[model samples]
Target: MSTDGVGFGVPWQVSAFQLPAEAPGAAELVTRIRELRARILFDGGRRPDFRDGEDYVDDQELDFGAWHFVGRREADGPPVGYVRLSTPQTGRLFQSRAFLGEGPFEDLLTEEGLGTAETFEHSRLVVEHRARKLGLGVHLNAMAIAAARCLGAKAMIGTSGTADGQDLFHERFGFRPVPGTRRYVERYTEDVVLMLYRAARGAGEYTALVEQLEPVFSTITVTPERALGDLPRAHGRAGSSAVTIPAPGADRRMDAEVWRPVLFEPQRAEDRGELDALLASGQVREVCDTIEEQLRELVRSREPGRKLAGAELERAVGEQLAGVDPASYGVWAWYPWSGRLVHLLPREEFRLVRTDRNRGRIERPQQRELMARRVGVIGLSVGSSAALTFAMEGIGGAFKLADFDDLSLSNLNRLRAGVHHMGLNKCVISARQMLEIDPWLDIEIYPAGLTDENMPEFFSGGHGPIDLLVEECDTPYVKIAAREHARRLGIPVVMDANDRGLLDVERFDLEPERPLLHGILGETTSADLLDLTFDQIVDLILTMVDRERISPELAASIPQIGKTLSSWPQLASGVALGGALTAEAARRILLGQPRPSGRFYTDLELLTRADRSTVA
Candidate 1:
């Protein structure tokens, strides 16, 4: 009856709703999803009772506050795919935590002061073999992500199967392997991986998907009002014993004016007894001794191999242990983007991993100089990637962004976001992506998009005067309009067109009166082209960029702009490379290095010609 994302002459109607276990067709839908999952997971129909039994991992209790998606060829047809998002409480009882024991999940929730009321679980995602090519998996995941965000959840985590390589598929939607929990599932028959996606707090594969599919997501996601209702209690409460999660608002960071030793415990108080028993055993003693010995050796390696041995070394070790408390040993800092809790190390020590590689290349003073500079980026379609690369590499201390356009389905082919972010301003989405990378980072946004009136304010120091500008807008008016302001403000400009690696750099700082685009279009000022027709605009852009030298694909796509294709073709790889190239140029320019303004091409086809010559 519908054909939203269907192909191959199959009209698939995708419906999203919270189906009560007692609903008219709920039981049958669950059976179809379960039977399909069983076949996929175990290679046959594994009944509910058998070890390799049917994957009927569903029930009403688990569906509380959850959204279920069922895709069919017709109104009365069997489901081609199904995916359920678990409610907050049910997410706490997620299988990965139940079987693998609580890890950073409990720690993460503790640090954020979140409860089951602010979490989600992606459970029971299955698609029939025949429908795999119809793009149903992407639709289901996108809808589920949107639904979770709608229900006021901050993050979603779930267990994925490694047996059928679903882990890789999950990565496409931005789900990453939970940092420390990877092990066998159900008596070692299959490997299970815990995956998580924190809504904001970093750029990731899934975040982009969410942004790309935002339009579709807005239509399919069910709201919490209709999804949550009276249902059976959760089957497995995650933390019911002594080592339980404290009720929200209870202070665990301190007690009686003393720092409490935080522990990564998410089980019941009774379960602590089992852990105490294990800690008391000879086995644990051996493990502790092994770790202590390794620590001693590490000190020796760095401390000129100072050999502290015999009673003398034991005395020193005891002295060192006496000054430290057990609680101070494993305090983890949570990184919400990756759902990883990294053990806190010295700032310099932790940063050394990247700085060491940059030492001789970037030099210490230049590294420090780069981090102190403020940069602004426009046009988040490609600008998002550039901004993130700058943040990840510690290239900028502050950032300002501008974009009036909301995320559309077409943008997802490159931008990092999910269905939940659909309809959001591009600037807001990019800024969120940047902040997720570094919460302390200072970022400003221009929601209304850049204009003649605000262009001056955008260039001057509002947050901080931008030392560099990465212009990536598609509007020819803004593109030229931005350079006019940058030239007057003496700011360097860098941009990449994401085709044939055409990077156009304008060093307005050096040549204040230099003709725009190196005078390629006959001294035409931004004002001169303000009233051009669409054909004139297209002709101006083509002539400015030298269409004769562009790649064959780009040249072909240009003339068909409003014909076969709605827009120019762009690949993720090209956009990513453009980001890296722009960052590299910006870094050099910011450091006062010799990166004078000019056009540069890192054409893949041209570079490969040398390789082909060598191969031949």
Candidate 2:
């Protein structure tokens, strides 16, 4: 028997056990193991016969092909902690005998065994009280796992007695609970928790967890203290102080500290200079008061955040600026009164309003009638700009948008939205902008692409189809689908394409046969030209069209450059003209006025030329 004492200068050791016949000192070691177990159970837990005379060493069935790891200290020259592994067939914890008549173990084991033939069972882990806090348990456990892997086990399974212990083991060692076993255990049973460890599976789970946690760590908090320094300062004489008032549309209730720095600060020197100029011009006080009046009227006029349109806005502005100089006041005259800044309005807004006022002005009755129309546009890339133009013109109408692509960084060059809108779906971003321009517009959205499959559903065919279809999708498939569908339903289709600074149009209603434009472009198939091997189709088109009618440079670039002018500025110009012409066509069609029905193209290049035929 062994009589090694704890904390008595014992040398700590870790080793694996082999069959006694393979080791010369096996007999003596077996005797020492028996003494160690007796002393551990008797002194540590007041329980004897813990092994039930099983002579674990003599149990060759358990030790012959299995591995046993023991942690020892020289002071006690005996095992202080140990973990054992055995094939599923030999381990008592997993054997059919240990679970016979106990519950559903037979069926579970049978199912798991079939599903995972490469897995083994771990059993017989015990630690003496002296070794409990010395890391011996963890050390022996790891060694047993390494041994199991060395023997080619792909997965390890084990059971834990307590929920807390099971949670700790799985949390630290990367184990997952086996599902669908709650009904198998008795009401008073110890609730055995089953776990498995697969190295590859563990690695994948670890990666996903890290990805989920990264966003949490990367979040930044913006505070008001940082915002105060960024507010625009008014310019003043050397001895005079400038008193700056919050602009009319500004939400004073919002804590200036939170959004002031990021949202109010001018990002460029020119912006600061402009703000100072406004202050030095002695118009700052009047502007601030005007802004206040505009804010009060806006609040009283409609629901908060709702945009104003048509007569409502004209009347609001008229009331706000009853006597200001329309010219010297600059474009920002409306900034102090409205929540929106003056420059935010499209340049066309001021031009259109002034021109209409000068000409035979549209009567209030006629304006109300025009606003009653509804228009649906597909492909927000260009369609959104068109929608904005129509809204600015006081064309009161229900507006619908359709597109599936999200706003990306590349869109900032031409899109009316800013960086905050990046990653949002285009339909939503555009719809919000439209509503901001004219809240009265009955806005609807389909955040999806219009395909041949869904075109019928998108256009009302049973009762009454949409009055017009504006196709702006750059894709050939969408263009063909939209054109063909609109033609069949007898709905006039007004579509636009951008080439350099020019806008190309194909009016189906003017000449019903003109819907054949899709055919002329060879848009029968869905394949994109971008995916083609060569520019044969484009070359053929350029050769077919009159040389004098198109730009010589553009003609030469077609086969080589294809359509690289699909940028935002080019597209925006096209959409703006398309919106203007489309609204004109709608007015002519509804008013029974004479209008051109065939293809018409407009470009800034044509305007620059002295010869009008260059526009053809």
Candidate 3:
């Protein structure tokens, strides 16, 4: 328990004191904290299993040697948050003796080789419901850790509820989940996991917060409206000024420069400086060693028509590897977006091995021809799947991805992205995914989407014009504008409506004067659609899609767009089929297979109707 008269000044105060505190106003502060905890944890029938009255009480609250860290709006205000630090010196600990039984807890300590005296327990963290988002919970937790470490503790342990992803939140702060030990607590009606935190394994954010708080605790007093000014802003609250995230390795913004993987060839002396700088920054989190497997496959690919014995294969591999520097044999690729360093075979051999499986159907010459072309994609929701399929199949060596919207929770239904990718520009997400598949690919991104300003550059930028374009945007103006540019550049365009797998291909290269959407728009120019109202745009889109031919489910749900449904619905199956259809059209067009400008439907509902198929 801390004896120091430490308390942060005005707007907010964070201070700790031993149980049965002697400081002025400490008893009232304890009463306020207890009231807050009961209101949050027991009110509204939250703890129905407790037959006792709404007054929640923990036996540890009366323990003498334990300490309580309290947070408030002002120096002597009602408590908004609370955390308890139970030291081993108290002769009574919460997690070891009570949470986990003494016998099993002793075995765990033996397995981990942890000394009781060097560890502390943090438990019973509670923040007012409305104040939880104000970062008071995080601040209280940090202060608990700071208090523990200040008292000569080396580790901390706690029990975390799993219902609201609290355990995952604790994991981000360096807590390790105890394997096979999760149990449900009836009082809270949620699974609880035991967690331990060692200083050496602390996350960067937690470590930084601890370091910042440790000095404040030692100083005995802090005088600031906001004590820890560097803490994260209150969630959902607008900041008064721009605030940069200060924790190392916490930045997830994938900009244009960082999206491209940096290649390092050891044989090239000029790459030394870049490699050294990357290492010095300590950003490389993973080093992948898969070159040996690639080399073995490379040896096998060179003699495709013959089978070699085990000894002969080894000898051939040895001959190919003779005098070859292991470090310089291939190339080292660094992905700044993911902090990964990978070793891969050189470009030619890598391509040969990668596409070796595509032999008979694609043929080596056709594969080479396909890989030489560049494809541009717009609107990366459904387009992301098409772009990735194109990458995996080696359909294009270079790609241009464009999208203005960032990923959201709703996009996960069809987009190839995770929850962590939310808020990232769709173009950057797609570019990073494609590059991960084939590091040799050349990709350019337009995070601003296809606008009137960058329309020309998107069509014919840098190393010449795109051979094909896959436009899948929903904006009426961009859709019409992109097609106008494609027609002018003589580039072919492909699109998937994602309903009934409706695929539209316009070979503007062949039919220079063909009307957009095969005359469906009947002279609706991009300029005319620019300033249209939302309702007008929807009407126009439905007209272009020929609403009569849309899927039954989609047609039925159209009337509920805003009243019940947030937006038009798309399924994974439909999005996947869209990718395949677009890829097939683009492949046939690029290979000069004479696919004319037309709208085609591979509708599964129509193809596999029960009335139509009775062969069995």
Candidate 4:
């Protein structure tokens, strides 16, 4: 029945025993009972001969089959502790009657009264003295309770000796003595305490108790005691009697597992031995398998159609890249083995395919190579459209995009692309669109746009300064600023004003001071001019275009009417004509062809006019 001082490192087996059927055998069952009693009396230091004449076994087996729980240090080792249970029995044995002294048993068992029905008696819990302080008593008691419940007992009753042990049952495990019970057990001892545990009451009460114990059982440490003010002083006063508080700062402090990489300095080579040992053990493999399983589940949930193949897939991916201009194509390489994607080259490295077959000189060339030209676009709206057109035209050179507004849903109506590009700043989006058109095109993105703060940076110094500044913005101040800045920086500025089917161009680089077209329009500061209400600006432009009106059809196509011209058919024609005229002006500037240096206006209305010269 003893472990013989065996160390605690080895595992132990715990088993449950069911009482035998039929009449008790004094030779076999009584012998086992005596052996159990001897173990309890000799090793556990309990009174010898606690039960006589097979009375305990005879009563338990006949009335209600008794179940025994045995804990052994090894598979074949003897029991170290045990507890007994009895089926429902009325009268003196029932703690309810003993505690109450006088009770209508039927009424006492109802919810209107004591709220108890069937009850079992818990008796004879004993542990070897060596295991007494080691939780064997607690273990045996818990086993008895569990066995009682398993046997369909609705309640459990017991009496405890008036000693310190009774306090353990009452305080630690929530068992309470029944009221008015001193007289009933006076025969045994005046101090004997009667206790009853209604299974239903215990079940409901324990649910809440278990809830309170859950965090403790789960080992979840909340705020650390050190993090709590006065905790140290309180602990010092209590000394050994104080509840053991978890280490100060231990619970609240960031867990090294989750946040060490972010907060702690990297471990030195000499300090990683423990980590290396952990990895060398099977722990690292387990963690990796868990992570892989989670990742596989995630991938299956999100992209069930995507398959990860081996080297053959890599070869296939490489083959797919054939004929793709490495410079033009944004090549993103994915390593299937590692699940990482890397950008293979800078976006600008791609060489644009020369769409123009005619390498020789052509008269009045409509296609101007952007490579030999420096074009600065002042706004990404009309400017972005112009840049894309210039790129598509194989104007293979440096182009500057300047705009402060980020791409928004409103811009999608006239601007290229869609909602996928909503959040990007116009300068970035326009530059990206140009790169997509001709990756070899030189692009300069002015994230701040053409403000006076960044004017010099875009115009004269740093990287590619402006050669031809295009003022596509409707801002009059920007128009003035662009012209003045370009003049001061010795760069040309071009701008297109789309009015109905009319594209008006002001070539400030060619004619710096011909009263600066904005000046000719009698507008000085862009802020002052754009301050005119939207409707007012539209009305003024309409008046300007109407003055040189050639036909009503062309006049109606102009955006000078604002939202009134909501017809897509009309808007599309105007935009196409505007883009064409803008492109033509850009071509003229880039080709060094004879063109108006001050301002030029092209009217689609004049196409129907017999007097084209007058309109021109």
lDDT of all predictions, in order shown?
0.62, 0.48, 0.72, 0.47
Q: Which ten residues in a row have the lowest lDDT in candidate 3?
A: 238-247
In the range 225-304, model 1's lDDT, one tens digit per residue, is 22222211222321111111111122222111111111233133433443343343222212221324533443343343
Which portions of model 1 show Cα errors greater than 4 Å? 1-354, 610-616
TM-score against truth, every candidate:
0.47, 0.40, 0.59, 0.39
TM-score of 3: 0.59
lDDT of 3 at 212: 70
Give the poorly placed runs of model 3, Cα more than 4 Å off: 1-250, 254-257, 272-281, 611-615
Model 2 spans with C-alpha error above 4 angstroms: 1-361, 461-464, 500-515, 518-553, 560-579, 610-616
Error of 3 at 241 (Å): 37
Candidate 1 local accuracy as lDDT? 0.62
Clashes of each: 22, 11, 0, 11
TM-score between model 4 and native? 0.39
Give the Å error, residue 533, model 1: 3.6
After superposition on all CA atoms, what RMSD does each candidate show versus the true structure? Answer: 21.6, 25.5, 21.3, 30.9
Query: Using alpha carbons, what is the TM-score of model 1?
Result: 0.47
Tens-digit lDDT string for candidate 4 (272-303): 33234323423222221122222233333333
